[model samples]
Target: MTNRTMTRRDFGSKVITVSAAAAAASLAAPAVLGAAKARVVVIGGGAGGGTVARYVAKGSDDIAVTLINDSPTYSTCFFSNLYLGGFRSFESISHSYDTLAADYGIEVVIDRAAGLDGNGRTVTLANGDTLNYDKAVVAPGIDFKFDAIEGYGPDAVETMPHAWQAGAQAKNLKRQLLDMEDGGTFVICPPPNPFRCPPGPYERISMVAHYFKSYKPHSKIVVLDAKNKFSKQKLFEDGWARHFPDMIEWLPLDITGGVKAVDVASNTIITDDEKFQASVANVVPPQKAGQIAQDAGLADESGWCPIVPETLASLQVPNVHLVGDAIIPGDMPKSGFSANSQAKVCAQAILAELASKQAFKPRFRNTCWSLITTDDSIKVGANYEATEEKIAKIEGFVSQADESDEVRAQTAAEARAWYDAITADIFG
Candidate 1:
């Protein structure tokens, strides 16, 4: 099958994407309830939750949307690598919910969701406030499984920053790199499969390499992987060889024995066959659904919430829907683009169910872009359709290894434009 690539350009950079007929029918709230407003409570405020809450609020006037989150501003994980590489700043990637509140009339509650009563349709907050809702969206994102790695947990976070959550930890990792000596070694330990941003760890390696090559020319990078291979493996290997040369050395589990333990106090990674010392260590452990999701009984034994493919309705919780990394998205790779796409499909489903709007066929799309060097980038993407069981990919595209300089530069430009466009699409 031919690779078909769809982007924000295809939909004019719109956030809520539904068929035209269905969109027309959903412009206004249906006059089912004379004066009563349906309540929608959204937990989480990253790409998925922010987009869904905004889309649903814009879908109808007779709907009251309340967005509950622990943080006032959300720092995105999508472009944090660029910050590490010195291409972007932390402030540039962070976003706030002011627009969703001031313009879209979404009640942005900056408080943690302490408890969820799915059967009662009530959400309890950390401040002891309870909210009743007709529908709820659970996009709380991922929480690290600290116990996955021996001798590593919350206590070790400050020393060996995971930086996966992309906020203060990201800053901490960047600071550690800046503080290290010229010839010091920086170690990165990536988690196993089914983690957020499948290609993220590799991208971090690339960005860090870019940083070291410029400032600390003698600095070295070592990767300790739990898996044998990674997403865009060939592309990453090619980039590392061409750009960094001898500066990077990757050790797969079979070669390194395995990631047995770590000593954060000394920044030492103790594998079965060897012990590696580092000036700084980034250990991204295994992850599960965020704590609130688990407390809400949204996750199954697999530690992920399973949702109906068509509606994104939580299989475990009635009247509650989930999107983003916390959910078991079959073909999706837990990316911001995937979460943003899923949120649109979910918003349309919510309108159809609660506001009596025509239902549209759900189409999901995702693209992950990684920067290799200045004005050079590669991307892999696929479009998905919802089935009875899973979101199955229809077609996909990837940047060719032998692409011309102009093409790679164009790909990088596309990524930057996408970040700007998507942030606008979600926040506005």
Candidate 2:
């Protein structure tokens, strides 16, 4: 958790390709056209939108770019778990968009994007102002399916925090954990497959266990998962067994019965077979693309937006692109790294289309790191290329189960370095 261990050497090659700034500069410029440059508008100023706006605007002064976000600052979901584990403070993960406006000359609008008029090629904000654009990029993250769970909704978040979107929910979850008494039971109800950050729930459990192990040794943690297996299942299971054997228990779907409901008043989760009592509950419900995507007609029946892999343009709406947690990215997990990588490809394609440049093959990469314990970390990543069919995975790497302590420590350091680099790349 110390900055001294996070060094340039620890990251080496992995951090080099994560940023979009250089990639934007490397794009081939179009032949001198006397025509007025295209106006591009980006919605939701998080990882995807921020990177796209920065890259496209910084790539060329001719193009007029406007970035619309509901808030002036962004809190990353990628490293929020580290905050719970006492590795980082909330302020450390929060970022502002001031540099994007000042350095890149991109107009930053702090307003909620209420509607998208694809037919008219305009984005309407909640304040009654409209932005007309030649091209649009929508990267609004996921929205919870409150109806998926019987007793948990937006109101229930006050008691049982999902902490999936970061910010206040994350702080609330941390407060709940700190309030629990010694020997109290903590329950984590993870969502099903295809959710954001497949390994996130397990990582949260690891962090909670780490916190309890240091202070309340008798505290117990239970994972009530909707799926039978999870990402990096063996690595997580191995780490749990090695570090906190009797303190953590994992109940898969079949074993615990599917989650039927929750009784928030009693701090209990109800399954088909039995009920789980908890001093605190972390219920991660099913999710879908943010409502704006659905309203814009970019999302399909699956409740996720589909995109042309090479250009990242929306399949249903022309000149509209979708990225981040809202898009159905084949062979890619919904992580901040994936979103930033996708934004680069998306930005390049947008600039090329606007400038009438030749098309090039698109390549993408993503690496997700999870801290199993204080100094023990694991990672899973892959390199992908766009094909006629889908974003096919070309190669992959993951932390081994029986790796040396030195390797694990290095991986943890690499994760911290990545967080620092990626946040700088996206925000600055």
Which candidate wins on lDDT? 1
Candidate 1 lDDT over residue span 1-428, tens digit each: 11121222332232233455763564433235334566788999999999999999999886778888788888999999999999999999999888998899888888888989997777887777777777899999999888877888799989999999989999999999999999999999999888999999999999999999999999999999999999999998999999999999999988987678888778898998788998999999988999988998999988889999999999988889999999999898899999999999999998877777778899999999999888889999999999998999999998888999899899999999999999988888
- Which pairs of residues collide in candidate 1? none
Model 2: per-residue lDDT, tens digit, 17-85?
A: 313464355442222333444578899988999999988887766687788888888999998999998
Candidate 1 has its poorest 10 consecutive residues by lDDT at 1-10
Q: Pick the candidate with the highest TM-score.
A: 1
Q: Estimate each model's TM-score.
A: 0.92, 0.91
How much RMSD separates candidate 1 from the native structure?
8.5
Point out the worst 10-residue segment of candidate 2 by lDDT: 1-10
| Candidate 1 Cα misplacement greater than 4 A, ranges | 1-31
True-vs-predicted CA distance for residue 185, candidate 1, Å:
0.7
